[model samples]
Target: MSTLSGAPAPPRIPEAVHRRRWAILAVLMFGLLIVVLDNSILNVAVKTIASPEPTGIGATQSELEWAMNSYTLVFAGLLFTAGLFGDRIGRKKVLVFGVAVFGVGSALAAFSGSPGELIAYRAVMGFGGAFVMPATLAVVMDVFERHEQPRAIGIWAGSVGVGMAIGPITGGLLIEHFWWGSIFLINVPVVVVALIAMALLLPDSRDPNPGRMDPLGVMLSIIGLILLVYGIIRGGELANFSAPSVLLPMVGGLVVLVCFVLHEWRTDHPAIDITYFKRPAFAAAVTAIALVFFALTGVTFFSAFYLQSVRGYDALEAGLLILPLAVAQMVVALRARLIVDRFGARSVCTVGMLLVAMVLAAFVMFDVSTPLWVIELVLLMQGVAMALITPPVTVSVMQSLPREKAGSGSAVSNTFRQVGGALGIAVLGSLLSTQYRGAIEGHLSVVPSGARQAAGESIEATLAAAERLGPAGKALIGPANEAFLHAMHLTALVSTGVALIGALVVAVFLPDGDPEPERESAEGAPGRALPVSGR
Candidate 1:
């Protein structure tokens, strides 16, 4: 097949695996749950973590930003290589190992006594998560037949919404009644459950024959992503892209990535088949995923602060406020396929991204006096827009590849989504920080002279400083809230613009009809049950 067509034969799962696939999907979702849950839980707990000791580790805003970015940098860096591992070594083994490591990292993160320790531990969690995320989807690709893959993927994508719903509310409850560490600690039991179920139910599957591993290619990819992401984070930190420290790494990273791509294109047995990305639909699907998550995650990172710090909601209350967003995601995601079938991927995605842009702009109207129901309505709308965007685009990306290349497809999908999120947090979060600092600097006179600079860094810092001053400190609250609102408004506007950019990409590139898969007819070859169904 390689000498002639270069495409592999159709995939055939063991009948046992096929029979147990729905159950196996549940186990995979359990694995995905902890990964999604960790981030969503942090959304609500970040405010508490910024609080002074006894309740939290008293992490500064920058440290908190680092905490999130550290996890993302490592996760994005390793994802493609991890996918290659799944394809070559085994999906089930890699999934189990990843879940186990996630559990260990969770426990370590729960025990971290300082911001630095927590950041390090979170990176460890990312290492495990990098493996878990792609393998689960690859396994889904393995067990399900082509026609049924969309439904399976929809439900699978919807599970992320479920995790989003459960995480915030659960974190809210735990934070209200117990230590903040309890949020991370809760992941331990879920991990244990996922591991056991995986052991019992998951089938070990891999490319029975794979080409040579490209170690140099893997190293180059890791280095390139880390450098690029580091540059993005630094730019956001300083809010300036011209600084030598920022420009150097960013330029170096781009050159390295270009080299890596050229090498893979020329080399036999390249780490990822770079040619697949040359397909328009495949490229658009990846772009849409990356851009949407970029808009969504950046907003998500700051909304917690806006809800709690600016609007005076407690952790539990803020979590509850976010429920509508997740609920809409779950409901709409499950039904997105039917809509796409009628309207086609291009129409649905373009329209969805436009709706997302509108929803983000809707956030601009919210202020101190805005009613809670107004916020909830906008959140619900946001969820529906995202749901419409996620499933079709995901299906497009996965369906483009031959079944044998599912691991790489899944890797391409998740890797960009994570990188988008990483950039979103760094870029948008930095915008919020910078805007708040400028807005509040003149008013920091309410704080002691020594603490004025720190107090103006963020709304949380300003509030914390005010509290330290006792009665005199109470004066800082008004200005802090006002400053954050200004920043939040600007960030939301920018996110709306990003969503529009995504919409434009989808409209210009994705096919008006569903993109046909390359070779799915072989899946049902008369009565043939050949294990090697393809080339």
Candidate 2:
């Protein structure tokens, strides 16, 4: 094979990876797992962190909401900017830096002395997550060939379920044996390993000619998201959407978001391609993913409280009970690609959403008297439904875009999901609070005014107040539990409606078959100008 009068040519590096890709995927998944785990692990530990004791910080319900929302709010706000940043610079570099930053944030969060401090640290972690999240998916898209992409994405999506599964159980064990802070401290070692693996295994990726950063778009998105989320949180906490706290930010955020859309439409170099929404498949996929997260996050938020506060399960027991949901999601997610290939994304996603709607409706049956097995069964069904929907919807969105825009696409997808989650927690959490307070108000007449305000604040507070009252508190316990159950039923009904609406949207709009193959653009990057594919 040697050329005449010349030494043999250097060994060629293959353009496509066939074997090493899987190793790369493993590294990407580890990074994804930690980011996802941080989102849910705190859910199980909320009570422990809020307990007024030597180890607890005595956070109010509003403070607790801030603790969760701060992470998601900042995460959502920074995601698009981070994704663009990674694409312009280097995905692997940004990912590594993100992991390092996340590790530092985790270490600080573990030592937070107050809820406010924890919220600040969580926001820092979220900033790191914004960098890490999109890069992981973008790298997967870069490394894997088109044909193998579905399976790789399925596995990637399944890692989210794995994180969900591990978060609560890990948090529970750590909180039970050590302290609530240990849940965060555990991330440090994991991050160290992830950083080392990512550095060694991941190939660098970036858009060689990515346009200038869109500063206006970044500011608009960040301000819009934070304000909207803050307004929602305030509305829920105050139980008055008409109040200035709710109205001003909510309206202002909406206006700013509309302006952002306009700005993107007019800009030559936009952070996100505003025209992506013109594709029905892309739009439907985004909506489906967002709605699913909305339902899942809200339900998980209340379910944690219900399991521990209402049902009298300890943290470990509650975490174990929630384990079935994650288990079912992980198992089914592994098979989602096959199912989608056999059927279609449209069919699979539609069915999944309907299943989610059905599961939410089933939650109405849950109460203090409901059997543990029944609760587990319902959770399992919800997990299966999410498994079917999430992977297909995500893959569809990824497929709809050109590979060159993978970072931006991943950011948009994740931003919507995180925003939906934040809104879910805010809206549903508010509804629960309002209903619980209303229902429990009459029953709390016997209690002192000072104690009554504390009891009305949250289920956890009510339970804690009752414990202090001892015998008198025993009477308050039954009503408080009943109020919580009532609120759960209301929220479930609302969630059922939301899920069914998502199902309808997917069925009506999402295309029935594979996406059209993308062609290379004038600049040699893949472009999304191909005609839509049909079944």
Candidate 3:
């Protein structure tokens, strides 16, 4: 078969390996589980690892923030390039190598003696994750037939929610029985199992005619994403969106990203095909996925604190309470394809987004006196909404891409989702902080000036101040909790708007029905480029 550029096609997979596609999926899911787990597991472990007393690393608040944000920044920065590289090289090889690297990073992290060391080690884990994440989805797209891809993608999307739900619970359990390092140590064995299975069961696939590497594009993308993520993380931590620390990096990152797009559009060998965004299915699907994550991460961030701080639940209890959300997502995700088939992507995703918006609106009514059952019900509905949206959006995006560009497509989808989540945490957390500070300031006059500064800083600080002051401190607790709740309600209101806007975008832009699959070259060469369908 002759291509436009006349490059030789890549080698075909053996028919024998095709029979074990389901086994391949299991391996992929296991690898995916570990990567996704790391994103959330550390949240529950942070206090234990950062406390000044016994079994802690004596990390400062800033250091604790970095322990989480560093991983995310590095992961998002490297994802696109990693995916494109896997497409050019062998995806299976990259996946195995990534798991091995992640295991090594986890082992090193388990032995970290300081917060700085742990932060560095987490960055290593993020690097490994970038490699593993996109490769898993790309491999799934390769192994599954077009008709069966949606269900497979649904299961894949469900694994992400499952890992997220289980992370905090698993961390809470480990922290109770074992050392603080146990959380990181747990990943080693899991990664080992994933590595072994991946090696044995997965088939290697790559774009045979993949052109020259776009080093400039890679550099720009990495720099832009890192700067953008860094700014967001710093903004949330400092609670000052207008500060130079936040605006400079954020604006610089945005400018560089624009440059990256222009460069990609002009380059003969682009890392990401800019034309993919022109397809309504691809663009709308990515937007929907990003919006879902934006809501998910934002709500989860504050709600975890609300459960433990205001509601007086233990860490383990809080994790358990959130488990229903994960369970609901898994159940609904398994049936997402059927829903999409019956109602179409536009209707299903739009309804899902609106459902999430409605739940966020309900959360605006939350206060210190709100019942636990009400919160639980909201979480359950949010999970169902997420399940409905994520799988179909993912399936649509993957279905729209050519087989050879699957890695790039997966990376783009995942990157946008991660960035959206990061922005949600940053922007919403900042809003919560600002409102909490303003609401509680007037009430702090009863406390001494020396104590007032610490008291007004955060809900935790206020509670601690109240505890130290005895009855007077206790007096402050009620008002402080109320203030925090007010902030949470405001944040929820903002999130509701964001979700509704996402629904509007989907309703307006996304096309209904399953996209027609592009036919392969007549000679069955997988590397040849096919004409994409117009929106």
- Say which candidate scores most in TM-score: 1
List the candidates ranked by lDDT, beginning with the highest: 1, 2, 3
Error of 2 at 477 (Å): 1.0
In candidate 3, residue 164 scores what lDDT?
70
Point to the candidate with the largest lDDT.
Answer: 1
For candidate 1, write residues 10-91 as lDDT tens digits: 4356666777889988988899999999999998999999887888999998888888888898899889888889888888
List CA RMSD, all candidates: 3.4, 5.0, 4.3
Q: How well does candidate 1 match the true structure in TM-score terms? A: 0.95
Q: Which pairs clash inside model 3?
A: 466-473
Candidate 2 lDDT tens digits, 1-535: 2334365532221344434788889999999998878766888888888798566788888888888887887788888888888777878888998889999999999999888899999989988988999999988877776778889999998998899899888888888999778989999999999998887777777776677778999899889877887787778778678999899999999999999999999999897889899888789999988888787678888888888888888777787888989999998998999999999989999999999999999989988889989999999998899999988888888888877677888988998898888778888888888998898888887678977887788888888888888887889888999999999999999998989889999999999888755545653334422111110
- Residue 186, candidate 2: C-alpha displacement in angstroms: 0.6
lDDT of each model, Cα atoms only? 0.87, 0.84, 0.83
Give the worst 10-residue stretch by lDDT in candidate 1. Answer: 526-535
lDDT of 3 by residue, 1-535 (tens): 4545687654343455557878888889899999878766776665566555567886654566678677788888988988998888878888888889888999999899889999999999988998999999998887776778898999998897788789879978888888888889999999878877876777778886788889999999999999999999899888898999999999999999999999999999898889889889999989987887787677877787687778877667777888888889888998999999898989999999999999989988787778889888988998899899989889888888888888888999989988998888888878888899999999998788988876786677677677778877778988988998999999999999999989999999888977646436656654343221110
For model 3, the run of ten residues with the poorest summed lDDT: 526-535
TM-score sort, best first:
1, 2, 3
